[model samples]
Target chain A: MTSDVETRVVRIIAEQALLEPSDVKMTDTPVDLGIDSMGLVEAIFAIEEEFDISVPFNANDPQGSAFDISSVRSIVAAVKSLVADQTT
Target chain B: MRRVVITGAGTINPLGASVPATLDAMQEGRCGIGPLEIRDVDRLSVRIAGQVGGYDETAHFDRQQLSLYDRFTQFALLSAAEAVAQSGIAFNGALAERAGVVLGTSGGGLNTQDDNYRAVYEEGKNRVHPFIVPRLMNNAAASHISMTYNLQGPSFTVASACASSNHAMGQAAQMIRTGLADVMLTGGSEAMLCFGGVKAWEGLRVMSKEACRPFCATRTGMVQGEGAGVFVFEERDRALARGAEILAEVAGFAMTSDAGDIVTPSRHGAVRAIAGALRDAGLAPERVGYINAHGTGTTANDRTECAAVRDVFGGHAERLVISSTKSMHGHLIGGTGAVELLACLMALRDGIVAPTIGYREPDPDCALDIVPNVAREARIDVALSNAFAFGGLNAVLALARA
Candidate 1:
């Protein structure tokens, strides 16, 4: 199941950053994968385009429940859940 | 009143990032417009814009900083860094607080908004990156500039469609003149060249399909652009005392509104803005050697701007070297005036006047000596920059040799 999730994570990075699965190193952080803020934004844009969700500016305000995006896998996991919710 | 002068300049436009490079590109009439490659543009109406090229976000900032800043903010910070680095002035405790920051932007984190919308509705993602607010707000650029340089002065953001930067620059100058601050980092930034972002422009129905052709009879509409241009403004006395190189004196500034329609521009308003700026500068209309026009290339804007010029200076309008740098840089929206003001300062410093590229035929209506197509070499005594935006916001800045 983790391997399946790993593939989906690789696909997310590939789809958003205009990179190949090989380009995205699973062992690497977003920084290692060359995913900077703008690239992260492009990733977010891709997820939005792929799926159709409107996330507000501050979802993770200490006052609020902002989800952690510590790594590519985490972002992918959150996105998968969102996609699952939509499909269901 | 204390006189305000431009001490340094920096930018990252479609053409190039640095002063000499960008000016050289514009002087050579380099068009930065190309096919959109940011996203899948197969479905979008607008396929091109003057997007900044070769911008590496992580290289510029740490991961935590990147998380907090939007692309526009990062552009602003980078541009501001360039300006401060070139200034050769160190900001201490007192100067930092008195030295304010005023930057402008039409779309604050708009790309973020578009992407977030996509993530929630389509991707079903409930988790957004924690720093979305810092990335998207219009003032993030100003804040970042202040934090980076220890500038605590009156820092704020200006939003007035494309006129935002001009307003911010003018306001910063005013703050210095009023003895509010000793220095300021001023200008504008914008990077809204995304798919849905570009699509929103289609609603305006005033964009060119091919390229931006300002002042040319074949011109269709304004071309969109993305980037930032920032300048360090300081008191002439302070700069001289500190042995700072004064680029050009920011002599006067004036802002007005049409109070009419949102989209359609007003000739009266344009005339008021130009004339008002001249009066504030306390110079005869003939004294201004160059006029950096807000020539948006739209049929309505060009005609209205031409009439306003005619109303103010009459035959002198022909004598003055007037041009729209927008022909090449596209309408940078918020950042246009900052770069345009640089054109004004450049005209003041170097004798050569920037040209309105793509100008083929003078629409009989806009029959001013619009330094057509080619750059002209002439010593400029005084230069004026004009910026008029949606909602009828108008800001005119006057500059002269120090």
Candidate 2:
């Protein structure tokens, strides 16, 4: 089981967009929030920079059906996995 | 038709803000790419970036001008002010509305938007910043330029991915030729060295691992950079009447689109842009002495750009002193073409072609005179600066000795 940084991440995203955390769905993708490709890039970049982790640049090949990585939960999950791997 | 000439130019590149410092670094063939300074790179796969450090507009800002400006526009406006001030060109009473401004930018206010996102998402806050809209909009910098310089002329921002600055410069030159504006403040600004910004770019998968090695077989991709580049372009007669320092003549400008793919560059677009610029400059291909390539050091840009050069100029491409200042300055994206154009103008003015530093190996496809790893002094009568961007935008500007 991983600690949920997604909870904090969701809260952060909600605060930035002036949306209630209650309105934020953990599975909802960045696209649902009107975060275009450019916006998504910046959001992901900001998180990586903040957490000091090297997230994979291309999470999914352009052609593949990428993981539903649109949510704060998924992003934080990815981050936690990296951190845990380093510690182990 | 009015003849446009560069009266003043200024920049805040990774090598250092001033023209002299950055030029010194360019002459010595230094790379400004390094690890991220503003963000925690512990987790990002891409770690390095070219950054403009500790440039607080508050230190150099006028109190009244601060309200209308976002950080990116603030940077461009401050640089423009410095340029116009140094140009010694007096603004005519009527030039305000007719004297235009065209600024280039790919990412505008991403830094401020990131902060606003942090505020709302992390804090679960309700109220966004009051200035968020103005700060986040792509045209904010151009708006600020108009207001700051009392420019009522046709003012707009050009956002064609990395080609934004060259687009702006081309359009400004067009305005002068069409008699739409007598004088124009043209350049670009970007602050993409921020945390969130880098993350977004990493997804593209074209970024380089070490330094940008344009025209090199060992090249990886481009090193991201952030900064602003500005030039004050005025009609030559107007400049002479005002005793303005004529840096170089903006002889010809041309633009094209690859219309091929969003990401991959089209050699077709590149070659046409080169040919179009040559025709607009009223010169033969062989008459051109040098080329400031849109050498992003990425595999796609360098190769396609070279093919384009060879296609247009033939054997002369081998003799041409082609170089990318991005080797030293990194890719300023939207601001790249503007500063690269400045480098081209400077080359024309001083007769010294700056080098492409990280070019160690010879890329077979990129077979051109890539002023590899060192600067060279030459007789440059006409120099062309090339800008090719994502989404197939291509722009070329020609500068000749006045």
Candidate 3:
């Protein structure tokens, strides 16, 4: 299930940057994938819609936002946790 | 005391794309408000706006520049370019350090926000463009203008709803007066006629679905417009030294909050600002011959504005040739006040008073001489441009012949 989250998050990030999923590394941040602040927001919105989970995020203060967006793997882990928290 | 003169001015509004073009339309009493031309027009109950005609993004910007500039920013830059061209001031050394950009815009990049929101929420897109943050920030237009012009001092934005431009210009004028800056590129821009823009305005119920007929008995409500008006404000001595063509003198400005209603306007607040502006300019109420009114075509606004004029001007109100150009250009919200200031300049510079078009029957509540239907030639030694916002904020500027 955690692996499923990883695959889905990786695919979404790759799609946002118009890159192949295989080209995206788990260690890469959104900026590493050529995603800008605007693209990051779009990716966040897509993720929120995809999982039906509300992500507490503020683009103006991304570094301090509750949503973990440091790396692709961190994002997947954060989403899995949020989904679990929402379902419970 | 330092005097501020308008050395250059430019605008891309519903009336026209340039200062001369807009003034010509105003002189002809042309109606610039028409059918809405945007996406999802069918969903909106109101379908009319003062849209800029014959605008081509590709014609104005290359692909690279287009990616960074939003509609509002583009309008600001284009209008500022015209103004700066007219001024012919080279911002190279000390001038660049002392000159800055201050602009007003209520909805900075609403079109960009709406498009991206639709893409993610409706189309389920995974990514938005990378420049969204820069494209959508409220200060984006001012920042871009500063960067383009190489202005290094006091660049910022003022957002006070409809009074945004007036407040911004007033701040710029003060900055020049107080020795903060020598010159300032100031005015306002708005591009809020998109799907989301109209959708949000629909909730207000202050919009007219047909036309903007300000001060008319059959007036319905206000109409939204999108465009920009920019000006180069310089010190009088500097302009004289450089032999710049002075358009009009920005004599005095005053701002006052109604401290009353969120939507409804306050007569007391409006009167205070008007009288305060005259006082600030050191002119008697009788000295003013023309007034550019903030007549939004709404029932409450026109009546209240008239009452305020009467209260401040007394017997002089009957002799004052007050008119609302919004009847032609619609209400540009944050950008309206700056655009209307052009009419005041026309009165001062060209001795032409732009008329309030679309006026039918006169309401008793608004019994002042509203220079109806046709432009009039008048010797306007002193003119006032009034802007009263929805949040009970009021700003008034007094202008004189240069």
True contacts kept of each: 0.00, 0.10, 0.00
Task: Compute the lDDT of residue B97 as modeled in candidate 1.
Answer: 74
How does model 3 fare in lDDT?
Answer: 0.91
lDDT of 3 by residue, B148-186 (tens): 989998899999999999999998998998888999999
* Per-chain TM-score (chain B), model 1: 0.98
Best by DockQ: 2
Question: Which candidate do you rate higher for TM-score, 1 or 3?
Answer: 3
lDDT of 1 by residue, A1-88 (tens): 4556457657777766667886776455667676654455456655656567532212112112233356666666666676677779
Cα lDDT of model 2 by residue, B157-196, tens digit: 8888899999999999989888888899999998877668
lDDT, residue B166, model 1 = 87
On a 0 to 100 scale, what is the lDDT of residue B215 in model 2? 82
Candidate 1, residues B1-402, lDDT tens digits: the string is 898888989988888878888889867867777777776588665677887888788888898887788888888887888888888878886787788799999998888877887888879999887777777888888888888889987899999998999899989999999999989999999988887778878545567767776667667777898989999999989999988888999988999999998777899998899999889889899998999999988777888888899899988987887899888888899888987777887788888788888777667878888888788889889899988888999999999987
Looking at model 2 chain A, which ten-residue stretch has the lowest summed lDDT?
A: A59-68
